[model samples]
Target: MTALRIDGPWFKDERGRTLMLRGVNLGGSSKVPFSPDGATHNGDRFFNHRDVSFVGRPFPLEEADEHFTRLRAWGFNFLRLLVTWEAIEHAGPGMYDEAYLEYIRAIVEKAAEHGITLFIDPHQDVWSRFSGGDGAPGWTFEVVGFDITKFKETGAAIVHQTHGDPFPRMIWPTNSGKLAAATMFSLFFGGNDFAPETKVEGVPVQDYLQHHYIEAMVQVAKKLSGLTNVIGYDTMNEPLPGYIGIEDLNAPGGIVKLGSSPSPFQSMLLGSGIAQNVGTWKLGITGERKVDTQLVNSSGVNAWLPDRECVWRCNGVWDLDANGQPTILRPHHFTKVRGRRIDFSDDYYRPFANRYAKAIRSVSPDAIIFIENEPRHVSMKWGAQDAPNIVFAPHWYDGFVLFMKSFRSTLAVDFRTGKVIFGSKRIRRSFADQVASFKQTSKESFGGVPTLIGEFGIPFDLKGRRAYRTGDYRDQIRAMDRSMRAIEDNLLSYTLWNYTADNTNARGDQWNDEDLSIFSRDQQTDPTDIHSGGRALAAVVRPYPRAVAGEPLRMAFDIKKKTFFFEFHHDPAIEAPTEIFVPNYQYPEGYTVEVSDGSYETDLVTQTFM
Candidate 1:
């Protein structure tokens, strides 16, 4: 067997090249619970068992080792290790819990023991601690003029609506008031703005926020750099589009506006004051949401349709003001704000990418950078030249047919042909074509840059029985297979959306049910692993290849009987051979086989028992 180096990228060997990206997301939000005594599994408030820990405490090191070993035994080569900005800076700014960093290091080292690669993702849902899930600490929101902790008491629609069970994580994007305010403040404080009022502790707030975030990330990167398999970092989970407004195109002249308003569509900063319609932003405002009928503009009034009604009924953000007139106030930041064709041709996003890349590399140059493009701009035609790295990453979703408005699935209307594909019976064609485009674009974009389907899973445990039929877990897997096969069939790599322990019964509501985790919160000392959702997904993933000294290796599996052909690559070497570990399975007549490499033959049963 040949020893192959696989720190990152696919490992090449003579027999079968092993794709190096069989990965899963270890949900990071459950590190510490808002309620310590609250029902939690592994110290996190969502699950009932203590199998996993999120709140700055170390999950039993032995358990961590076991988890890694299990992942390897199950044929996973990578783990998307998630750590939140909040976890590092929970106490306050300029303070990172040194102990937690050590724990992370231990986890990485343990993972290495199991031959797994680790990619540190600064995970967050809807921005930061103030919004939900984890990222920047709660204090960071104060720079945006809002106390995240106060949202619980203020009865703000965005905050209050999410307080119930099954925390509506990303759903806040459907409304954009509070999120808008927060983003505006972040940009105002972080950007080049030097206004006196925007100062935090006498320093510009934008600078302060960006500084703290980068500092925290640098600390983690430095601590984990020594680990061989630790790859790059996911800079910040889904950065917001900053507070900019877009117009209701259906209005006369297809015109849009640029200002904050409660609406779900993601807004993008076209260039400073100029903006464009992208997707809906989540509204986060304090007190009862005001709705004034007189404010409605008949010329551009968007009637309450069934699909649009939910934005209003669920207390979601809408562009309409309190009186129902469009307002400039836009919601949350960085939800699918992708780099545009124009931006690329003109070279606009490079500065942002360069700055972020530099910050990460300063601490860990050996790490492989994983970059993502906004899905809106990352459609079938887009290519990886737009974003560079060993990992040309992108996300996939089944669109409105699955997640609906709660998710930012856009209605497909071929902008090139002006043909609406959203409500057509040929929807599958649109979906399939988009997926195929990803493969073709990856090759064309970066000359076959290593691509990874960074995200492609869905929320399960919803009340409706029809959800699965409509693409819940099972359907999500099927759709994911469509994308996964696209990657696998194309020899691409990937990591599933998540492996949180919060999925069953929607225990960790903090992640909005996006916790496509495998573990169930069964508190039994040794619970039956009936709901280990990810294990069920194992069938879809291809196994890792074993190679030696730069020669390819071949291994065959009997899917029907769960067995492996543990033969080495063809080599005319010395006589004796050693036995290798193969998948255990039942052979009714007791196993017996002959090993041959065309020129030689070996009989195992006739060999010595000792």
Candidate 2:
């Protein structure tokens, strides 16, 4: 097969045409291949538990082939090939793991053989290997004199949480260890304070690390460049804020600098080779005086550490000299530090995204660039801005916590005042507004580039007491149906939260342990029983409906009449289908409905037009 060349706005073959991706995230395959709950506290290190070791490791290559091939059979056209920075850079600084890179390439080639396009995503969790996710090596923390082992001993929330394993999609950015890792990266990678002499062989620590990160990704691209079905690249997964300003990398005043602060790397240089006067010295990595700060100590102590003095470095504040009454530092840290917002000004986001886009184009010019934006980081409009050939990949989640009744069962909350934002009507409005904003943003940011719904999904384990009591599962299903209706109305492409099990049969992270599979893992169920269903419906349906201008779509199922086989005019006002798949039951109308063919009868339970 010839290599695929993506030109202009659409994802096309050698022949130019628009393409929509129907896919699932193989999230746990590369790094956290095992279940999230079983993840060990020792970073990627093994504790011999049999469980944690497998987290994110590719299942046998043949198993991967089977998984990818099955997805193609299901009509999925793309795969978000998740690879972590640690998996490829674990050999330490400046070294790319050749064998690991090859391992990823083999999977990509196999996926292509199944006609699945690959989107290389450098996935990370808390931050790095030491921070409880597959990412940069444990040695990354050592660069700053941080002892990973000590963090585990004291139960550092950044490295290990205090209570239960906070499941995926639950840990809020403002208040987790993930934020700490981001801060460290901001300092080390973005050129914050460090000892003057502290350098990686004369190069700053941050520069060296960024170089390694870029190289690993470049290598992954180069190795798979010949694969036609490999479609795109997601540069970094869920980037978090660090100890510097949220806008530090592109702040108006400029990126934060640590001026003369003592860096651990500098301290190491002084200790090893650099000779300096011993009298005038600094005991800590930073010399700034302490002040009242809301910053939670990673050590869990209330006392302040000098290095943590620059709260603005992590929270996005600046000292003003306009009035000039006096020079004063301000407290910008929030109770939700990870929730600290990055300013959306062009000066900030444009540079941030463009940098990554440029890096991607440098390595894989023919690949379509899928850019994902955080609903929290900036407004949805942020996705609209920046780069040619970029596709906006925004995530959506039904505020799982607010509606969560127990560990298992849950429901969707009311929209406006509901607990979580994603599933509510208000969020639906926001999503609509974003679609408009993205269209406008694309014009300004990426030259009217095509966009897609990058991520969206809800859990399926709606069983047990919690599910039955609140009917949370059912409500969530209804809300999800409505959500998909909206997406379909917009004519957007999507890749649902995930594929099969991850051991914990939870939401997007399930390791294929439950009945969620389209193919039964059970020996009991007959393979030919179409009713022996896989939960593929959750991932398959496009939420909304689409129609050409001046042409509204017709209704197939009628809710008011409670019947099927009834033909009706299209309703342009409604973007999503009023009628949802209740499952199993055929349309009430006498006409036999063919779902695969979009034909059904009435008092057809026909819903509104898309």
Candidate 3:
């Protein structure tokens, strides 16, 4: 196998054949540790993060071969392998888990045995287990004098475990706009600029946090340095801007408007035990709208340290007035510095991404650095010096399907344009346009670099998990087909959201109620049948041109017709033959193939039509 590299707007092999990557996020549970019951809903044993192990996450070494074989059979040669900050160094700063590192290396080797290539994804949700998500270690909060146990009571965060049963579906994402995550991200990225007076152990908070994160990832690079299959490292998963450039802290924080919505100022007030009325929005088939206003955190929980102060307060953004009421001290503290307007991506995210790239390349010089913009921020301009050997890896989703938990092919809504698309033809066109726009952003802003849709897939347990009981996955298939069609329409490369080995109908990804994994255990009644455990195989398993002989003009697949079509202008200089992955799952009885100008040979054993 030859090494893959970025060349202009497409990925190329060592022989310079244009490559199209199709794969899935290895597993969803990689975000949490395998030991000590790190499931988000398990509140009893989460704080003991110092004595945890991630040896069996994704899957144990013994079970790797079976999973890998299934993936290869489904035609996934590339992977967005997941690793987390907590998985690498959960014990504390400067503490590396040699055992976990060895296990990861072994897993990578096993993946290579089955002809799979992958890039490391340092995955995270809101922030950490303590803050209702997963990524940073528990000690991260402690370093800044935050008590993890009191996060819920202080109105700083909402956790599924502490909040208990009947957990609102998809509410955990709201944490990104809440107090705890917003504050931590602000400090992590802009502590020196936004919170100048807030320090952790005398070191600037921004430097301390970024340094440790880079150091941890560097350790991963050092371990997998010479491995050809490990091509690169993602800068970070869905990096957030926090409140860095919020013109008005009193206004809403992000684009997501489902469930409880609070402004940065309101979040600060709530964390300080001030009861305030915040707007609440609800999502339906039509779209999201402000249903009503509700008073939250009225229990008077203080998400701050006892006798300690809010970091923003210590930074002089706010202070106690003469009557013991909180008052704004510097209204424009984060909005501007020295009379200059601030933009989160240009001012903060870009610098951190460059730093991460440099640190990783210091160990593996030729490694590609995958960069992602903040999920909510508008795209920023990229120049030559921003980072070399980079790939624009942004995430996209079928917003309606993801949030509504239902599929409606006839009616689709475009989140970017806020336009409601009618009919299946229009919906498919809308989705394709949205995805292509990301590629266009890469070319326009970053000098025509390669673009990979880092994350995109549908929730398998849709329509109240009806398929689990009835064994009818028609809805799931339709939803997934719409997303996959978009990928094919743009001729884009992407890794589907995930394939969790431990996915069960009851627990669903071991975090929140997100059951997007393409594989599940309960569905695997027959171990010998490779597709037994797979969910919505009709939508996921499709024919694609793995490696093209020249520049690819267009590619499409008709799932209902069981037909595949690909057209490319042959490049006479390149000797590599075009390789198309023809999955047996898509054509069980064997189907006929057609080519325009070239004679092709079929290799049934490898399932490739060359």
TM-score for each prediction? Answer: 0.64, 0.64, 0.97
Q: Give me the overall lDDT of model 3.
A: 0.85
Better of 1 and 3 by lDDT: 3
Query: How many angstroms is residue 433 displaced in model 3 relative to the true structure, after the best TM-score fit?
Result: 0.5
Question: Candidate 1, residues 152-200: lDDT per residue as tens digits?
Answer: 3231123322366544434444322333233433353223321224456
Q: Give the runs in model 2 whose Cα sits over 4 Å from its true position.
A: 1-16, 33-58, 132-134, 152-169, 172-179, 192-199, 246-359, 378-387, 400-440, 462-476, 504-533, 536-610
Model 2 residue 506 lDDT score = 33
- Across 1-610, the per-residue lDDT of candidate 3 in tens digits comes to 3589888999999887999999899789888889877777677777788889988988999999999999999999899999999889998899999899889999999999989999999888787877888888988887876777777765567788788877787888778878888888998899999988877778999999999999999999999977889999998899887778787877776546677778888888888778879888886766668888988777887777686667887888887799998788887888898899988899898899889999999999988998887875537878977778988888989888887788887987886876778999989889999988888888887888888999999888788899999999998998898989888888889999999999899888888878999999989999999898999999899989889878998888887888888889899999989999999898777778777786889887788999
Instruction: Provide the overall lDDT of each model, using Cα atoms, as 2-decimal numbers.
Output: 0.45, 0.45, 0.85
lDDT digits (tens) for residues 1-610 of candidate 2: 2244433433433332234455667654355434334343222434222223232355556567556544544456566767776666665666666766676777777777776766777876546644544455665655554544433322222233322254322222312222235435454434423222334556766566666677777777887777767777875666543433432222211111211221221221222223222111111112213232221223333111324222232223333358742122333331123455433333333455566667767877766667664344423344434566667665654443222322212233322233334335555565455444544554565555665666665554543334423534444345445555555445556776555433233322332121122232332145444333344343243212221222223333232343433223434553433232222222223333344334333322222222
- Index of the highest-lDDT prediction: 3
Judging by TM-score, tell me the better candidate of 2 and 3: 3
Ranking by lDDT: 3, 1, 2
